[model samples]
Target chain A: MDLAAVVVYEILYTIAFLALISAGLAVVFGMMRVVNLAHGEFVLLGGYAAIVSHNTLGINIFVSMLVVAPLAVAVFGVVAERLIIRFLYGRLINTMLATWGLSLAMIGAFTLIFGPTTTSIKAPIGGFAVGDYSLSGYTIFIIASAVGVVLLIFGVLKYTRAGLIARGAMQSADMASAFGYDTSKVYMVTFAAGSALSGLAGGVLAPLVGIGPTAGLLYIAKAFITVISGGASVVSGLIASSGFFGIVSQAVTFATNSVIGEIGLLVAAVILLRLLPTGISGRFFRDRL
Target chain B: MTLNRRQFVQGASAAGALATVPSVAMGADSIKFGSILDTSGIFEAYGKPMEKAHILALEEINAAGGLLGRKVEMIPYDTQSNMALYTQYARRMTRRDKVDVVHGGILSASREAIRPSLRKAKTLYFYNTTYEGGVCDRNVFCVGTTPAQQSAILVPEAIKRWGKKIYVLAADYNYGQITTNWIKFYAKQAGGEVIQADYFPLNVSDFGSTIAKIQKAKPDMICAVLVGAAHLSFYRQWAAAGMKKKIPIATTTMSSGNEHKILTPSEGDGIIVCQSFSPQADFPSNKAFLAAWKKRFGHTNDIHEIAASSYDGVRLWAEGVKKAGTLDRMKVIEALESGIGYTGPTGKVTIDGKTHHVTHDMHLIEVKNQTLTIAKSYSQIPPSDTQRVCNLEKNPNDTKQYEIKI
Candidate 1:
């Protein structure tokens, strides 16, 4: 029936949303072991960058979201890694504290510029009819984007020399350095890549949520939940956890309403963590990335 | 003699006590009007304008030769959108600053947080924000449009224009919950049925699934009671899904914080929002108020329902003080209870002596190019919903927010 199709679409969209938001955190936390608490703020900055470019500079919405937001955030990521994150390397607790402070500073900086009001651009795509029901065409774009991003990450890590070097550096910096690789350069590039993914997620989701100074709070908890619950294997774990949480949340949302849906997602995450502390990937996808 | 530790502390304490005496004496020369609002946080959109409105009102009152030959001094406190600070500042304003009268509490929770303290201190409180109404406190005056004054008029009008199957999407809070009930009450009166009602927490901005759900229900119209910055997304997402053109929408909380301006012209246009005030209201006093605001603040862009109501609230309190001829708490209360009214930008806001609430004119407005265009005006709708439960005359000691059961 039309209802079933719409529900399935919603479930897929939710999964895509979770994956998109968590992809960057998975790379930074799971792969780098850095635990970037400012992951949410990085996403927030991307949204603001998209809005500023599209609304103020009169750039095409798609171009601003796709190119400008990620590039801007990637540049910031490089600077941040150089100035603060570099010194805090190999110190997990210190990185968390430093990133948390960075998050607060980003929020303050954003409020100074944007003045605490919600700002957003209109969704590029309009709704299209699906049988008897109509849904946002942007939903399809988001699902596709999520798929592309996951594949892109997977392809790079599985094939490219840079991705191989980055993975090797993350696994054993001493071994990679002995192989004549600059581990520092690898860390910087990996961090920037993670930040860019977060930016892309923020840009894609901007039309739905509208960007504000405190907007990061909405996605931070969910991103952390998804990434942490996914365990150590970045791509496979992110996919697995995002899939489980998103389906549970969206199905509950459809059955009841959004409040209970959110509660349901949180409850599922809690139970999942209790049962498998190392996460879904820890137990199931042990050797898969 | 060498000073011991206890004697040295006593000497410093005495000096501190002596320093406070002169400051307290200086403060007594002018009547202190305390204003508390969240001027620097997420709620700043609602708070900053309200603070400006209060200043304008106070300035106007003082410019008219000072109330009772004594200058009204403002003692403003920024609550910073924190509920705990509301209580902290309320106590400070009443006990430390000893303000004669206090105005400003943006959220209903903020008002509730400080209302009892103000009542205990007998500092004469005025909460000037549109909220769920059922407070029967004789000590406080609520000068905002309640559900009866808003939803009772908006729902029926929307039902008459659109079809009968009304879909409700309200925020998950007392304001949204109670307002949705009022909408239902009025919708039934107009022979309409709510096809579905959904509640969203203030932070849930994603509405993709909800949009699909709405399409499935196929309601004639959507009645939104959403609030805050996050809830603004529903409007954006609803339009993005191209549902705005297909189904008309009506809301009770739009334009209060200038939410219409936040959305783009295409997205916001054709949405109906009923409120107690509109900047476009054709009134001489409104024009003057806007002119004064422009002259003082350099722009009238931020003037909205709650801002305008805040202006009227301060003016009404000044009127009560002038009539009483003294700032005595009981005397001013008596004067206010004598049906004090002020005709300002909102058009004749009169205190309902019975419930200590206000009866004001409501305007049904449509958003056109990011501006509210007044389509129809209903005059002097009382807080009938609160009136049904609250009777301050009979039970003067009553201090409870009664939730109306449908």
Candidate 2:
């Protein structure tokens, strides 16, 4: 029974892991339709920011992750938007090319500054035993943070004025502009928020996994798969897709090993994409978001 | 402007001599030592120091009046941790540049990728990295300690100190796969048993389920054959789960890179490891090498086992060249096969001519507060694992890597 509990916890943790990593891309690519190929690098940047602040400046680890990492990446996102991304708006291929270049450049910069080895911070929380298995307390924190981030994204998008304006601007920019709202500013803030969310994921995961310059490659594919597999509506699609992929991957993983489990995930993605041409949200939450 | 045939022939002959002079004369007059390493990407942490060690050894050889009375020239290439580029660069070094001897290849995969090409080109190749044993190429000298040198000592010592039930966590590759066999071999020899052995790919960072599985199995200790930067997470994750207190860990793959220094003391402390070289080893040869490296590089922070092995490899090759008194490949191989030995940073390192592998004084060390402390020293552990399968003297044409099959 304890083994079963641990398995269930692991499944939930995997789901949370997917949701956290995909949330940023969901905002930028799903809602904004920006096609950010460098979303992974942005996460890497956030990881470095948190690590640098925590280790060098002696800031608290949580503060570094929660406050410094996201804020730093958000600032980077704003500058990136103004300098490069602003011009490539609406040009999908161009944005991809530009962001791909940006990712490479960010990786280079990271390698130059941080060196090749991974910089790791100690996990703040300790472990607790449930029956026969002793599980990492950090897992619970990650799941909680993932839930909080999703609800926060949902709340801001659905219940707030800025969220409403941002959604309207994304849906119909010229119409929103005619109604006396600035679409460009909204897009910029949304992109910044997206970058910030990526940073948060990176920061939260810093302790669980060490972050190197090229560490972003590990997450980029999985994040893109989750976000794209979710399709149009950002929050609903993210939650639903995270739920589906996370459960599938973890189930296979528990049944066998990680290698086959990863194969199972890609296979499931192929089958899922074939069946629901849109996504889970495209079918179920089509009218909600 | 109509030139006669004889005049044109004379002009062509002059150009031909000039073309031949650079390739033939340069090869004859200087020792071209080619080095290929991943100096930029993820493997740079290992590669940079190895590169520096190569430079340092070449510099020392040149200072000592060169090898065979000719100046040693180093031709270095950074493969940037790409596997395809390793073969590409190896070809360029061997064919285009025509380097006499080549050293460098960190991963076993990288070694295999370039080993065939180097053999085809007749370039003397040296792969100076710790790996699973049984590479029996006559033309190549693997300078790093293997599973025989590491697991033979580490597994038994761990069993003696910790307990008999061992849980194995290893990277999913040839190195990890074969090393796990050696660990099992040694564990059984010591009247111990492996409860569970898990294989994780180099890219797999999360060890949540694996850790739980290990705990459920209720192993007394863990034998971690994890590799690269990504696998460093196992230590962090293990510590985070408070497994550090519950169960101890021993590793054969901890110190080849900067993974030990990368982890915090809380995360890295009390892990048992067996390596051939450590900066903490107090020996004259080691001290001199460290001094020279510090002088050249301004810090000894980047020094690791592979780097030390690389330094030893270069010096060992130079010894063979000195004994043979020629830049000829076969002659040097014969001289090195006569069992050349050198006192290096890791102490007396001898070439096991039969297997074309190194014999080293393996150190049993423990990671305490992010630094390695030598607990006990074992001298001159031969590549017994490779020797069991590979006998180059009996079969000189042997070029196969014999994996240990249980």
Candidate 3:
């Protein structure tokens, strides 16, 4: 029974981790249809921001992770959108090429600023007992944060005027422009918001995986896998696919080990994509936000 | 003769290429010491200091009236943490520069890339880094501690201090796998049993499931043989789970890259490690080395075990050359094969002629407040693991890295 609880906790944590990392990609790619190959480096930038603030500036851990990191990355995202991403919009291959180049540049810049060493921040939460076993309290925090981020995104999109305008512009830029909406402004804000979400995830997860210049490589494939497999709708699609992956990956990890478990996740994704090319939301929750 | 513009340019370029070829072979009076290291890119944290140590050692030699009463010149190539570049640079150093000796190769993969070419050219090579032992090559000298030098000392000592049941978390690579084998061997010999062993890939940073499994197994102690930046998260997650207070941890592969400094004092404290060098080591030679490093580099913060080893490696080769009184590769090998020893920063590091590995002092260290404090010292631990499989004295043509059978 104790083992079962730990397994459940691990599954939840995995689901939350997948959801957290994919939230921003779900916006930029799922909604805006812009493939930001540099998504991982943006996350890495956020992690560096968090570490520098907390470790060097003597800031509170929460403020550094939640506030400083997001703000720093949001500013960077705005500049990237204005300077590089703006020109490459609507050309899928060109956007990919530009962003890929941007990824290499960001990696180089990070290596120059941070140096080539793994930097880490201690997790603030302590352990809490569950039956005979103790698990990280930070796990619970992460799960909560993931849920909060999803709900916040859902709430904004469903209820706010800005979110509606942004969604409309993404769906049909010409139609939105004809209706007197500044679709260009909407794209800029939406991209910045997506980058902020990524930065937030990077900040929160920075304590778990020590921040390095190439640390984003660890999360990039997994994040892209989650977002791509989520299909059309950002919220419901993300939830559906991440739920499937999180359960399978963690259960396999428990049955065997992590390396095989990772293989199992990839295999499951391949089979899933093969069967439903449009992804999990393509079949179910097609219209639900 | 009057020539067209294009023909003139081509002739000038051809002449320039011809001129450049012999520049590498210039300075016939000095010995060309070819040094290759990843002074940039991903492995720079490890390679940068080792490069610094190379310069420091060379400058010291030059100050002492040079090797063989002639200036020992260095030819450097930055591999930039790329594997392909290792072979490319090794070939360049051997074929073009025609360096008399070569020193450097951080990762095992990097070492393997350059080793064959260096051997083919009959150039004496020195790889100064800690790794899985059993490199049985007559032409190569591996000066770093092996699995036996570290895990053999750590496991039994950990079993005595903690209880009998042990658990291992090793990286999913040859180094981690072989080190785990040695740990198991030493554990059983010391009347302790490994409750479980888990191998993690270099990029597996999330340890939630692994941590929970460890809690269920309830091992008396944990031995981490994890490596790289991603695996460093294990230490952070382990500490976060409050396991630091419950299960004592011993590691064979921590602080080699100054990982302890990466972790906070609370996270790093009480971790047991066995290595050859610690900045806090209390010895005259070590002190002098640190003093010299501070003067040269402006600080000693970047120096690690491999930096010390690299410094010693160059000095050891210089000694061999001094004894042989020649730059001829065979003569230097013969002189070094007489069991060359150098008491440098790591304290009396000697080359075992049989295995081409080191027999050196190993320190039992504990981490407290992000500092390595030496608790016990074991002097001159032989390269028994490699020596069992490698005997270059009888078979001088051997060139294979044996996997020591448990």
The lDDT, on a scale of 0 to 1, for candidate 1 is 0.91
| lDDT per residue (tens digit) for residues B1-406 in model 2 | 9999999999999997776667766666777899999998878888999999999999999999998789999989999989989989998887667899999998878999999989989999989988788899899999998887898899999999988999998888888888999899999999999888889888988778787778878999999999878889989999888889999999988877767889999999899899999899998999999999999999998899999999999999999999999878999999999999999999999999899998889999989888888999999999898888999999999889887676
Residue A24 in candidate 2 has what lDDT? 93
**Per-candidate clash tally:** 0, 0, 0
For model 3, what share of native contacts is present?
0.81
Q: Tens digit of lDDT per residue, candidate 1, span A12-57? A: 9999999999998999888998888888889989999999999999
Q: Which of the numbered candidates is closest to the native, going by highest DockQ? A: 3
Worst 10 residues of 1 chain A by lDDT: A127-136
Stretches off by above 4 angstroms in model 1 are B1-9
- Give candidate 2 misplaced runs (Cα > 4 Å): B1-28
In terms of DockQ, which candidate is stronger, 1 or 2? 2
Interface RMSD of each: 1.2, 1.1, 0.8
Chain B TM (all candidates): 0.96, 0.93, 0.96
Docking class of 1: medium
Give the DockQ-based CAPRI class for model 2. Answer: medium
Q: DockQ (Cα-based) per candidate?
A: 0.73, 0.79, 0.82
Q: Which ten residues in a row have the lowest lDDT in candidate 1 chain B?
A: B19-28
Candidate 3 chain B: minimum summed lDDT over ten consecutive residues — where?
B19-28
